[model samples]
Target: MSEPSRPGPARRSRLLRTARRWTVRLVVALAGALLGVLLLGRVEAPIGPFDATVALRPAGGGAHLDIPPLGALEVDAYDGPLQLDLQLRRVDEVRAEALATNPVLLDGVVDQVSEDLRDAVVKVSWMTALAAVAGAAGASLLLLRRPREVFLTLGVATGLVAGTAGLAAATWRPQALSQPTYTGLLVNAPSLIGSAQEIVARFDAYRASLEDLVANVGTLYSALSALPAPGGTDDTVALLHVSDLHLNPAGFDLVRQVATQFDVDGILDTGDITDWGSEPENSLITAVGTLDVPYVFIRGNHDSAVTGGLVAAQPNATVLDDSEVTVAGISVVGTPDPRFTPDKDATGDPGSLEQSGEELAEIADGLPEPPAIAMVHDPRQAPPLDGAVPLVLAGHTHEREVTELEEGTRLMAQGSTGGAGLRGLQGEFPEPLTCTVLYLDRATGALTAYDDVTLGGLGETEVTIERTVVGPPAPDNGETGTDGGTEPTGTPASPTG
Candidate 1:
């Protein structure tokens, strides 16, 4: 009856206009609610109160943790369970020894995302449900007067929730697979200092090896089976072997004395010419200037890579950079430090040490013939000489004053040739570099090694002319010492003693 009364044009127009207004308002409200629900669905986990502690143990044992409210946690080897045993506790604690394992990246996608968004998501989900119910109730109330508007609002709300959920699911992925965005050196100051101490200890070990080598050389000189006549032309082959000079002036003097004493034919300046390669024109090359013969050099890790390039340009100098050179009919090979390479590859799997070793072997192969002498910075590179090379010259591991590895290829190491002998006295650092001369005979290809300079005064630190003859009845050539090996038999030319 009321509708029939609305037959009046003004009343009918007002009614129709009011209905349209109501429909528009309903549609707007529904659309806004749907959009909000979608946004809420995309939110992530919120930050929660948390604390953690990791205590390492040793001996395959695990770690013990006291997280307080989180309770004490015990982790075993490979992050195993934590036990009460003292040994077990030590196993985890021992992680302090490994530099790489100590600091580890945190895992899990939840950890990678922000906590605020997570909390927001939870809040939005619950709120969205409430919103949906409200929307439905409002739509129902309008059904009698604006059925089309009510239906439209309901459809919009549902679509929003569905769309948001779908988007969130599509974007979700395991964060573990993501590459690391941050990195830092894990070494602690104290640990670094301790490592330095270890290096010093290693240098001590290196020094020890040099002493042993010196003793052996002395023994060889003392027992002369038969002095072989000097072979080759007036070009008497002088063996100039200088080790661990550290580019110090005093070291050069020693080299000069030895050179004059042995009358060296050629010079074999072993590893560690300078304290580091960065400082150019150090005592090593400066002292080398005094020598008239060809000078060959191999790099020590302590030497700077930059300086290594410079050595090649020096007069009468042949810098061996993973390459070979032919001097006096003898072949020589050189290698840089191997530590610069990594143990793994792009796949995150362990790779072969062959990458480094084989390259070195190849360099050694470049030598003119068999029974070649190879030079390197570290002793670890001493092994696997590719059989083609016999003598391996090394200096990185200073024998704790003097030591040796039995049953392996002959390894010549000159302990620190520096003044203080504190040279390379860090962890596993070779002893102060000692100086030695290597004599290679072209006729029979026989080789003899000698040390002209001791770790003493400045006069014995420079490079000198050295000459050695290999034949039956080796000539004294003013050099002292017999075949049995005592001191050099040649006369002291420059005062290396």
Candidate 2:
């Protein structure tokens, strides 16, 4: 046996060169494969009523779900070099129109939506797999030049994509969906997407309770609307006034029912929609969006910047912070509170209530057109605004009140729309949940009359509505009184819960 078979130095060098050349080729093929997959590893499918695209990309493993203008959400559901992204494009026009006509129809179509979603996923998977392989092979051919190299690279690419996908499937954690990070308007994704099973069970129960509460409230308002109006209601703009909801689910329900029944052009909320203004609390703001009417809001002592942002993010909402806006032919101005009393101690702006009130008055003065109404969370902030606007609306004391300022400005201080919040339950007697519907002359934008609707606390439900007509400006008296020279329009039959 010739053990003297050792190669010459030239042969050894040739071997090394071959190894280096193949290594470079392998690296290039892998890069090309990744590029191809990223460019074409996507497929469009019908997900429920939405036309959506599912794509695979070169990224830190996970999933990203995007719903255009509304926003996007990201979850770390899996681990690998490749990630998935789902985007909703155009929605089915017929289904969209149906939802627009009546949003409640959504609950009835849940099962169909789920089935469509599963079908879309299954379809997308096969399409994406084919796209990945074809893309990889095409890209490798462009770079490799040789048929043998291209074929080998194509096989390698297939294995790589397959393995990555398999790994993701094996490691995917449904729990990650509960803690997704959010962007844009979908900042409250957690409220909609919780963990699997247990969270789903809890959410279902909560939803059922909320629906029942809304149904009962809606029924009461239907009965109340049956009472005859005082006439001259035609050609008048109806506006719903709500404040101090304190994040009560029922509060939004009441607003929705009243707005729908009265056909109000807009909703004016004087703040304290949430208790702490925390991120979790912001989720409740979605209820405001569901109202489907223009919503104008201001911050209350209990609200924070977070609360304001959430409300403003709603497609139909406008946040007034030392600003003015017109809704349904009515001009309005509002300023945030000088203090944020999250606890016993107040915080935020160092300016006194007097100064804040003056600043608000100045803002109203600066507007292009004199406002029809001025809104403040606290009544103490209304004195300076007396002459700046014809009417001022406020809420804070948890009790409804009507007052005439020395400057002839008529003020209507609203009661808590949330029955003074959860705290109302602590009292011996149930506090009433109250709101006002303002009737304004379309041509003059003047407050003609308003109805004060008060309902007994969360569980109580007895409802009362008083129609009050305003008589011109209390003779500009120096003293402040609750009457404002307005007369009530006799008690009509009300609903009892």
Candidate 3:
């Protein structure tokens, strides 16, 4: 067979010029389209009471929500050349507060946010498409300097944008919301992302739970506010005690509600903030920063260095691992647990628990001044610290107990603030979520009184709060002055935010 005929020099040169010309057109077109979207693809709209913006940017095809200050939540919504960016901007505090407090307002807020998000998405989509086409045409006209080439480039850009949109819509995965990846804390995940299908779905299933929380807060406040505040001196500081949250969302919500209703000066957590020390469990602790009060934490057996680090990273959080911090006019010291019970990487000696307690006691005693309160994850560590501090707090058994030691130290063992976390629901009956509100005399840092708060187990919303006044025996009751508290008061109620 004869060899294939070769093109003449003049014909080859013509073909090369044509190929180079087309390559330049494609490159300039892509560059212009990217710039256009970068400049004009954003749209701002009010989502509920929040001002949020949506934009398209170059990324590996996913959606990201920027919550500002706290952190960001990212979801794999789709695959494409461009990623979706949602930025949370100014919020109407008055309206937001009302929505959080009122269930009726929250219902309207859900619908309002849905409508606003839909509108913003639609607007941004159109803006991005137009900008891409315009940019491609402009660049082609400027560089190619040929009207025919510019027109061709505009058509190509428009086709490409539409094709990309079609691909994204086709590949959109709603399941991504179930498992989102986040930067910072995962608590602030995007409420409305993925396909538009969920926007119209009803979320009333959570209304009763929310209502129960609101009603509980209101009734509890009513019951407590009617009584006079307790203290030896007029200057008394209040603190909220929580522990064993184990990554429960409802538990965190309750914590926030109780904190707000009581207006506590600070919060003391005895640890186990997550079920597993994995990265995914960081969401529950994110709200710790939003509590708007000093959060003092001690690591429990279920906690790890990562959990402690996360807490320490928060703006209002302080983690004490054999360290001391003064909050709300009270000096506090704490020590982390000897080991994470479920840790696979390290098997710290459980036998060292007592030794750890002794070390913590020494640290507390060595402080410049005796601490008002000392913290440990397990009650096992409480004995050694009896004389080191006036009060010692610990949690680990998921039970509440108060005892006055021989050396004159009061040990307050808190229950699980998260109902022992999600594991509490695995059995026939769920464990009750419990916490306490402690009152201290500001001048002398003396124990005045405390309220033990309990929420009914999972699937139940009933709440009960018991008031225990600490002081000398009252002659009126004629009862013995035991470590067990007197003047016990209880009320039924339910809470969350």
Candidate 4:
């Protein structure tokens, strides 16, 4: 009877230890689950129509198109789902299936993969919990075994802590989980993957051509800056203002080097720093952090729609999405290009442009005073701001250096600061070769339109800035100059008030 009673006490002790071990495992699992949630929530999915325009066109089937670089997409009218086919090439078939079945497909491939990936994450969480439970059991057992085993068990726990912490930190941010764009999953899958040979060939061709254009333009911009200032002295802030450098670090590097070499007082990046609006730790952010000067940024159409997260991360950088800010003594009002109503299913109901000239007018009214300069995404959008503003700085066109607009209101098209070059997916490289537009003073109506030709060895051409009087000289003091003849004696054309 005494022997049986002794075994019962030992059994009770074992049961108690097991319960404590499970409790520890549960804590560890909870910790891992929370960490995964925090990291994934921040991941970005870039969405846009640029990729579609480049890779796909109307091939067949309900007038649909496909862009493999973006995804196998089927585009049609947005109102109703009609005849569709998404051949690894057609794209419509995939869209129709996705529409009828899993809407997650429309969310983008990343979202689809994430759903599958979640299970893996849960398994790892369970494993972590299990390890912690085992560790606790081991500890309890050691404590029970003898007073001296506590030291050994403590050593084991310390090693486990170091190992687990290091691994969790290392693999916390995954680049794989972040590649989905707004249009669809960028990753390759049999159901949607297209021709590899074609993609590679096209990419190679693009790369070579891009290299040539970049080299040429960099040289041109450098050359322009080297030109003697119109006035002997620098009248106003002469800084490089570029925007929409979507995730191109090489381009950003050039901008930095030019800024540093020229000793520009400020560097203003209008917006769209990343290819996608919400990606925080990619090449773009890494490069943006390297600049050691005051950098001002305004959201562009792509910036707000694709990589808006960069703005939130860099507090020192000012982000003027729908606001106004002053830089280098010039008050600037900034707005992204008109919004487009995207077809979520890749069915082509032409995207609607949602430009807010009225909103800008309202913002302009609140200005403490008239702004000397304004930065916008599209030069064509400048009309809505007629008479209210003097200068509009924009970059969507990526014109070689400067392409003057129709309005007397001077337009500055700051070429590619950096990102997939100006060719876009259509393979139309930046115009003006090695040029960027510059305006000396909006208040004085002084504008300098030329390419910066400084980046050597990038195949850049020398661009010259020649000023030609467009219309007959401003009405000469109410007495017009006779055709090709001298003006009225002693009557000079006074500056337009």
Candidate 5:
């Protein structure tokens, strides 16, 4: 027997080389096909000459439209001139003209444009798929003979494509393509184009309504401007008093509107600017600071130590916790709340509230001139400062109240300016939003009159302003009179523009 001839070493090596070559070719072919599929998936074509026109009248801000199947189309005619721009993928050429000059011709142009774009998109998408397949097949063939070179080429191409896509994704904004200079209507289907035109007409009518609204607002502003300004005396300084905003952004707008309408010289905030005293809640300070007048703030239980720091950073804000500052000719002092948590009954350490009141009283005693006004978060804490200050302003009760202390000091406890500070939004029964505008005798720094403005609770829209006079007789010599005070006389007032 020939003892089963064993394969020679050369023959075995040849067989191994062939097996390895075939294995590499298979992997390369699979990889090439995968890369081609990924590239193809990213390809997109524009379905245009779809016509889109945007008409914006000067009075209205603008309107936007995106016709289906096309990339995106935007027009901005806010400045009274038609500006249009169209964006589409794989479009060889696009012809657009301002249809504003000829309304009758718009429908025809849009029909032509839409049809052309649909055809182009079909052709482009098909062509792109065929190219991707052809490229993948060619790469697979090249890998079989030139594996090393083919790998290098594939890697470089993949890197380039990926890098380009990433850059485009990061920097591209669809709005950037909608420039103000481009003007035209480009679409293909007459019916679709007609719909687009109808949309523009409706938008134009809407713009006309907006124009009327703008004119009415302008007229209202003029009427307000012509009205007698506040007391018409530099001695009469108005202060907008608010507190317990609790992160309600609408409160800021309402405050600004009131301040502008009242022409207040400054703002006085008691406390509870935020609910939890967090870092993110600090953004409320920017809105508060934009009032463009002196802003005196006091810390509340909801205000953390960081809240104080943020308030201090505002240009027009002053943090007054156991501290006194003179603003708008009146000495203002503040006492922070004792509690750190949300519990109304929790006053932190047992003596903290008393201690805070004592500290504030001490500060007031040391002042050469006692503060014209003292502010605290809780009215319960106001009695300690009763005779020490003429007026004690406070929040946290979520209900507005005015009391005349035996010593002639008045404690004005304001309602929650943010409608119970978002807690009102959770329940069916929500607290109404309220704020006060105080008119002070610039000379005596005494409260002459005040407006208690109450708006609908939480989501309600009713607003009522009750103007109240502080006297049958004003306080004597800037101090409360010895004679027993009369109840404040109030009359309803309309909200001025």
Candidate 6:
């Protein structure tokens, strides 16, 4: 008779159903509470016009001072504060509240805002956890009371929350968090009010200086175009020499402007067109193709075989590495720098420089006619070609220099035309941006006269143009010519501005 009291299948089934119901309800409640906390999280809103002038120095020892959005500001002397306007458009509730409390000290305001944001985030996180637990308990109780309607309730709640979120996302337009306005003042230790006035005054001066610089550039261009030909020779050809462009798009505009102004017959580029020779960087070659004049290119240490191929493909460009080409009646030969650094850490083949020099020297020795100009990237490699070519032109050293080698050969090292090839932006003192206008004798195909134009040194925005004459190559006897010809020296003159 006692065996009749044992648990039956129906009883077991009922107990299992109860457990399942409690589990489902508990899960729904937990999920709903979590969703509630997330929905109640802090929202960012715009607070009315908030603007402050903050003085900042260079983060480290360098000439460039970065002002967000305005980019790095190149300063001649880092002895003063570069005042800039910091405008806050919209911020989270925590940040807005913090800013409202202490609007005086910029540093204090920033610190408070940061602390408040962290606290808000932490508070939301804890609330989310608590809500999740509370939601699980509440959902379980609701399911126990009305099991039939639980699914309908959950479905409606989910649809409403999802639709609301979707609509908000679709309609919401994000605005920039902050905007920086440059105020061209270099105050060493400026008071708050004094800084504002100085900023305004300096800003006005900066605008005027910019206008002057533009006017000077225009005047310089006009003068270059109108210059009289030496010895009244109409056969004289003007060639613009530039190098180490390093993907600076500004180089294109400057080159085009100079080429157009001077009626340049051709342009010689000595490589480093890109920092890294990647496929995407090949787009820069398009700018070269747009030039109306012939563009002669040779790869530098930074260039790759792929880059050379791309330059060769351009309609207006001729890749002259290890090759000869006649441009504007001047016989030109070029050899690309053999040292190839694929990445920053990868040093080029150590012996590539010597090998390349030898290869180029051999090519020069075998030339049918004396090349008017020999182009290479490294100056060290140029010495080998002495006496093989009349004039040797190279870059890599971002400084303008002209030196006569032991042989009759003359080496003209053009300064970087791309403003030291983007290294100028690294906050260090950058080499002055330079380009040369070479005037060649038509019959002789020899360099006659040249103009060296220098602009925008490191932090300086002034332009300087110097004119110099090139004497005929030294007498073939490996001795300085007894013809009494003097090597031309650069005569510096300030720009019109």
Model 6 lDDT at residue 245: 78
**What overall lDDT goes with each candidate model?**
0.47, 0.75, 0.78, 0.45, 0.63, 0.63
Ranking by TM-score: 6, 3, 2, 5, 4, 1
Worst 10-residue lDDT window for candidate 1 reads 81-90
Q: Which regions of candidate 5 are displaced past 4 Å?
A: 1-232, 342-350, 472-483, 494-497
TM-score for each model:
0.41, 0.58, 0.59, 0.48, 0.54, 0.60
lDDT of 6 by residue, 296-394 (tens): 999998888999998888898899878899997899889998877634345555467667767887887788877788888878777678878878888
Window of ten residues with lowest summed lDDT in model 2: 189-198
Model 2 off-target regions past 4 Å? Answer: 1-29, 46-51, 67-72, 88-94, 102-105, 108-124, 139-151, 183-240, 243-356, 359-374, 377-380, 383-391, 395-434, 438-497
- How do the residues 1-497 of candidate 1 rate in per-residue lDDT, one tens digit apiece? 35544378988899999888766655665545543433332222222222121221122323233422213333332222111121111122232223213223122222423453344445645556556535554645554357775565666556645654464455443442121111122112122223434544544444344434433433333332132324433423446656656555445655665566456667776566654343323423544655777878776655566556566667878888778877777677767664431111112111222344467787666545654667766656656564546566666444312222343345666555553233334233222334656655565444543333344222122222222321233255855335323222453333221
Q: Model 4: per-residue lDDT, tens digit, 1-497? A: 35544557788899889777555544443343333323321211112211111111112212233344454433332211111222222234444455435534443554544553454334434444345435544544534464444344444444544555454445443342223222454332212322334334444454445455545444544544545443333564555677656555446656776667555655666555544343332424645655766566666555544444455456445656668776666676777656431211232111221245446656776787867666666665566665566566766555534433344455555655553332232223322222232435434533432224322212222223332222233464675543212111121111110
Question: Per-residue alpha-carbon lDDT of model 3 for 452-491, expressed as tens digits?
Answer: 8887765566677777767653455666554333333333
Winner by lDDT between candidate 6 and candidate 4: 6
lDDT tens digits, residue span 120-159, model 5: 4445334434433445556756655565645544554444
Looking at model 6, report the run of 10 residues with the lowest lDDT sum: 77-86
Q: Of the candidates shown, which would achieve the greatest TM-score relative to the real structure? A: 6
Error of 4 at 5 (Å): 72
TM-score of 6: 0.60
Judging by lDDT against the true structure, name the best candidate: 3
TM-score of 4: 0.48
Candidate 3 global TM-score: 0.59
lDDT of the structure predicted as candidate 4: 0.45
